[model samples]
Target: MRMNVKLSPEMERFIQGKVASGMYGSATEVIGDAIRRMQAEDERLQAWHVAVRVGEEELDRGEGLPYTPAALDEITEEAIRGMHGNAPACRDVLP
Candidate 1:
């Protein structure tokens, strides 16, 4: 699709720079890459919103756990162990 886009002087120079630097073949490629990145970011934000909603619903159903220093430490340790390719010590810490 061929569409005309109006850009400010700074934006025009930026696009030109991308092409001159051999990073992009043309202005179209540069704009297309930018739009694709924006779309990916939007999808990530949407996923976060869904996660927040699920968490809120869980809290409403009284499935929330109390925040404690011990719990935080355990979680941190588990995360670190997982990063190190070790199996989690406790699968079910909450009862």
Candidate 2:
């Protein structure tokens, strides 16, 4: 689809720079890439919202754990171990 887009001087320069630097073939490619990234970010935010709702429901059902310092330490340790590929899978920590 061919559509005309009006850009500010700065944005025009930015798109021109991308094409001149060989990072993008044209302004359309640059715009398309940006839109794709925005879509991915939107999806990520939606997933987070769903997770938050689930957590809230669990808390309402008295299924949530206490938020103690020890719990924080344990979660931090688990995250670090995960980065090193030495921890149990994330699902194993639930419940």
Candidate 3:
């Protein structure tokens, strides 16, 4: 497929740099990888929103954990640890 797309000079330079680094083959490959990541993020966000809604509903029905700052922090930390453990190797790219 062929498409005409316009990009700011800065973005063009960024893409060119990625290609020059030998990590990506071409601008199209870089763009496609970026778009795929964006799509995955969108899906993840949608799922998160759904979970939030479900949690809200549970709260309305008095079926959720009691509200406590300490408990919330603990839950958040646990979730983060679980996610990090399950995340792909790409996450290792970060410190």
Candidate 4:
């Protein structure tokens, strides 16, 4: 495939440099790699958006747990103690 496009001076130099360095065979390879990376990033962002939406829906239905600050502090302290072999794990303390 043949295509014509314009790029900033810096971007043109960057692509040319990659080819000159023998890492990329040609400008097409650099552009193809850049597009692939952009696509992967888009896919990751889409997955994150879907996860956030699902979490929001769950929150709307009150499907999450409620933990007080004091309770969380106690859990953290217990975890630290467990790490030091001074107490059982927090899961052991849970019902």
Candidate 5:
């Protein structure tokens, strides 16, 4: 498709250089790539928004279980069980 685009001189030169270096077939290809990146970023932002909404709803409904530990050893043991000696020592957490 033929489209008219007004670019700043610096942007035009950057696109021209990419085409000259064979990184992109033409200025349109570079613009298309930039548009694709913006779209992917938009999708990720949308997913994050949905996650935050779900978290907020859970908080509003008080849907959380409090953690109680009678011994520090239990906390350390639970944290270290799945770790292959590669994780930092767990700290005492209060809830």
Candidate 6:
């Protein structure tokens, strides 16, 4: 798909550098990869927003348990079961 668009100078330089480094064949390819990533992030944010909205509605309806360290731990562990180890926080992945 041929399209015309303007890019910031820094972004243009970055795309050219990627091509020069042999990471991408052309500016279009670099732009395509970025577009794909942006789309994925958009989808993720949409899902997260829905979850947050629903949770808030539930709270407004006076649903949910009282805060407790163990309860929080259980919820956190279940959410991250497939993310890393049994329950590794994201920070654990970096350092």
- For model 2, residues 31-66, the per-residue Cα lDDT tens digits are 999999999778777777888999999999999999
The digit string of per-residue lDDT tens for model 1 on 38-82 reads 997787777778878999999999999988999999989977877
RMSD to true structure for each model, in Å: 6.2, 4.3, 5.2, 8.7, 8.6, 5.1
Which parts of model 3 are misplaced by more than 4 Å? 69-95
Ranking by lDDT: 2, 1, 3, 4, 6, 5
> C-alpha displacement of 30 in model 5, angstroms?
0.4
TM per candidate comes to: 0.81, 0.86, 0.73, 0.66, 0.63, 0.69
Tens-place lDDT per residue, model 4, 21-73, is 99999999999999999997787777778878998899899997678998899
Candidate 4 is scored at a TM of 0.66
lDDT-wise, the better of 2 and 4 is 2
Best by lDDT: 2
Worst 10 residues of 4 by lDDT: 86-95
lDDT of 6 at 4: 90
lDDT of 5 by residue, 1-95 (tens): 78798999999999999999999999889999999999977877777788789888988999844556755667678766847677565432211
Give a tens-digit lDDT track for model 3, residues 1-95. 89999999999999999999998999999999999999988877777788789989999999988769999999789768877896654432332
What is the lDDT for 61 in model 2?
Answer: 100
Tens digit of lDDT per residue, candidate 6, span 47-71? 7788789999999999968899999
Highest TM-score among the candidates is held by which one? Answer: 2
Give stretches of model 6 more than 4 Å off: 75-95
lDDT of 6 at 71: 93
In model 2, where do residues sit more than 4 Å from their true spots?
A: 86-95
